[model samples]
Target: MDELKVKKSPLERAKMTLSVLALIIIAACSKVEGQADLQKRQGEETPIQVVSTIGMITDVVREVGGDEVDVNGLMGPGVDPHLYKASQGDVGKLDKADIIFYGGLHLEGKMTEIFKKLERQKRTIAVSKNINPKLLRSGKDAGGSEYDPHIWFNVKHWVSATETIRDTLSEYDPEHAEKYRQNADHYIRQLNELNAEVKERIKEIPESGRVLVTAHDAFGYFGDAYGIKVMGLQGISTASEYGSKDVSKLRDYLVENKIKAVFVESSIPTKSMEAVIAGAAEKGHTVKIGGELYSDSLGEPGSDADTYVKMVRHNVNTIVEALK
Candidate 1:
């Protein structure tokens, strides 16, 4: 007969579990310390550390900072900032950044609290804040925000933001101020050309076809800048919810105005817009998805709309081709 095995007491089992958790915690602490040490060593030799919230800011930082700065974009292609929140990893990135840039005016809705906290101690700047108040469109109806945050839609406004980025980077890293200025000058020229090109391309569409409709009200500045009438099912922020009433309103508008095409934003879902499309069809109106617009974010790397200029051009071309 085998001896009966004695089970450990609950207390003994609990102690063992505690011991295991302690060891795990210690290991994690050690790993984090090791990573910090490595980062510290690397930082001694690296360029200015920059963290930007959106791809548009990231692109501008990289272009202006050039080889003088290391820029990390927190939000990537198709990432909507309006609903994005900071994670533990993002906290670490923000902690390590010498400078941070974001679109202001509540564009980063969920991250506003974190940004407000960081503003107390860090060089967290809002690029959109550089825009003139007279130029900003109001989004008061959409969650009571004072102004629209989608300044990038207007090429001229974006150009102003680029200068702001340049000035900020230059102020922080004066050693590379000349380089930044040169880069900014060159980029500004490119942006000017892009603006000209966009105007020319948009001219391809007749005045009757210049109405722009989309899932959200992101294209207000674009429409204002380029002579188009814009409508949206939802408000400025994607965080805003659209209901049956909104959908019905847009459906009726589409049918009444004979707007043939609506665009889907890369960073926003197409579900709502799809419903609008179906609703219009049911009402005996034909509306198609003109193309994917780079509204809140840029396209992925190696794509045609990866860069800011490319993105603006792509959007302009799409709008023109669809509406023409």
Candidate 2:
């Protein structure tokens, strides 16, 4: 006897088709989720691009932003920000940056127009702009703005600038705001300690020998905060011309006061200070060239004054060792 063959019911076939469709939908959803996860990972891996005008600002951003930012400084070691002009390469860097930080009050006088133009297109900031006006020293640069931009010399003022950088970074990347705050707090504490250290070190110099004579007036804030008298051959900006009369005046002051050492600036030519030393020698006063101080720029990489903190410590050490 032969067995009878039977066809499957339509409902049973429909049920099998729906089961296959459901599997495809689930697989598709999983693929989409994997792609989303990859994108999120990629976003987290990318750092915020930053362009800073000077080394001090660059160091602060690095300290505060930590691993979250990639900073490129336009003016490197031994570069004068007051006279620094933006190159084509620098413009490209600025254009590509997510944020730009500069020392305001005409620190980068030649590049002011570039920063102004960039402000319209990006988050351009002047780190010194937010500092208390009362803390600022009046500028004597006839061709420059009305205030000195060397706020970093005073560690306390720099603490304010650090806070500004932290706030700006936090505003831009809210996910890393807490990280920035923590980093800033740590940095500020270090600065406070540094401030105290500087005060104590400065006191080691005899009260009469506490005068700091440098190539220019860049150390005004430093002298003010540390209770040292400051004199310079030229005005606040290196752009100011120091003529024979100015040199004579400084030379006479050194000879009259029996000052032993005057510092040459890293960013400035040593010829002017050398001239003053020579003039003093001619008048029977022995004056020596003190160690070079990092002014308007940081020291080269691997040098003692390369970073901001190191720069401050190096300057104080050099000054005290020479004058005390």
Candidate 3:
């Protein structure tokens, strides 16, 4: 017996064609992805992936590693490293990073535990490790850190940090060791120039007018390096609260010293400094808010204070102009 022939509808024919095209596209994509993966595994010369907790560390890594590193800073402009916590997305980034760098010395107070755990699995370095503990300032509060973590404020110390970055990168990527050393040497020279400029600019301020008061004590290193007296409404960490007594004491000190201005940090709340100002005003002293200073973080992209050197220059200029 002969079977009857069946005619397919136009819609059915089109659907079948579309299904075949989809399968073909999927197969092609899979093949491409597999090939890419194979290439990656075949000793491809990709940039060394790095994740730095703060922009200053990121800037140094980029300057030293140059084209050899692909770096991402976890914290950006105006971020308070003392209180910044890593999100799930940040953890993902950390997982993929070949190396991680942080300010350390409890500067990254919240992420300290996370970094400690990450250190076991990957190369995690604290740039501040190279700093001499003797050079670090002692914390003022009863229950504060023994050593201050704001070493970057001292340009000379940061130059040492650049050496640590160079050695770490060279050890991890020996293939380009000479390149890393050369880059670091160049960057160190730039930092030296920055230090000289800072000293010269600071000289513009009168001896008695060199007091730098801010919302927090982030500039202890700055004060020590540049011969300025630094005061803050809060302690070494922003986590420290100020009592009315603390405010009154600072108010009396500012009035006695005839301080012209008090500065607010970019990452810290203005209320603390405002309270200090009010207290000083009540004591019959006129204190102005000096321009905002980039403390824990750098300024936004395209701003004059975006880079480390620029940030320092901007701060010095602001301090000198306000006080002079």
Candidate 4:
């Protein structure tokens, strides 16, 4: 009987060990299934695909899309989207794009007509065109081609457009509506904080010393944002001719204001800016060339100011340091 009891004890111990092993295997199998389901769900959900014209919109879509969508911008960093002419590759990109996002309000100068046709089909909206007329550059007609399209200069304007973007993304991807909302919320917060920071930095320089002279008139909205008078040798679009008239006008602004510094833009030709500086110095104003500012486009890859947030921050810091 004692031998039988010892044998039974060994058998019971063996049974218990097997039971634990079975539980572990069962649990692992359940976890594996769960992970598989996750992957399957992700695969089942079709991602919203977009083709954007400009860097700012591309940056916004990337921030909002995260992993749920794929976005490609036709214009790369420092490539002026305003003057971009569609290539065969661009046409192919447009064809494959489930939704096309182009900065409306004449931003993509030659591409406006292409986007307008899509708008009639309810496939596109003028993202920046919806901003209040007052906030845009003065004298720019509200509904006319004369309007300046650089609404991204004002963060408040950009935030408003972000809501439009959020709505558009939600309409197309109803299942991911909540996700888009959260992303837009986060991005808008960043923009708000950025706007405040820019305002604060601009305030460091007194009003009398507040003139911002640059290579182009891209900063009209920026000047309107911070109450600084701005003058540029060229027009809003870098494609505009930097005529001798524009250069002389910029030189005059620097000399008349006694402004100590002028700025060069990343996308525009700096030689004209150098001329402005030289002309100012000829008048004994001694204007220094400020650091490069991202105007028409953000910086190149791996740059400190590559992203929209960093671009605005870098511009503000450089402007403040130069003027102050």
Question: How well does each candidate superpose onto the true structure, as a TM-score?
Answer: 0.86, 0.86, 0.87, 0.82
Looking at candidate 1, the ten consecutive residues that score lowest on lDDT are: 141-150
- Which one is best on lDDT? 2
Best by TM-score: 3
| Per-residue lDDT of model 3, residues 1-324, tens digit only | 889989999999999999999999999999999999998867688899999988889999999999999999999998888888889999999999999999888888879889999999999999989788888888755224777888999999999899999999999999999999999999999999999999998999989889999988889899999999998888888888789998998899999988979999999989988998898899899998998999999999999988898899999999999987
Q: Please write out the lDDT profile of model 1 over residues 105-167, one tens digit for every residue.
A: 999996877888899888999998778799899999765279989899999998999999999
RMSD of 2: 11.4
RMSD of each: 8.6, 11.4, 6.5, 14.9
Better of 2 and 3 by TM-score: 3
Question: What's each prediction's clash count?
Answer: 0, 0, 0, 0
The positional error of residue 265 in candidate 2, measured at the CA in angstroms, is 1.0
Candidate 1: stretches off by over 4 Å: 1-45
Candidate 4 or 1, higher TM-score: 1
Deviating ranges (above 4 Å) for candidate 3: 1-39, 140-143
Candidate 4 lDDT by residue in tens digits, 63-135? 8878887988888877876668999998788777878887776888888888877665556666875677766
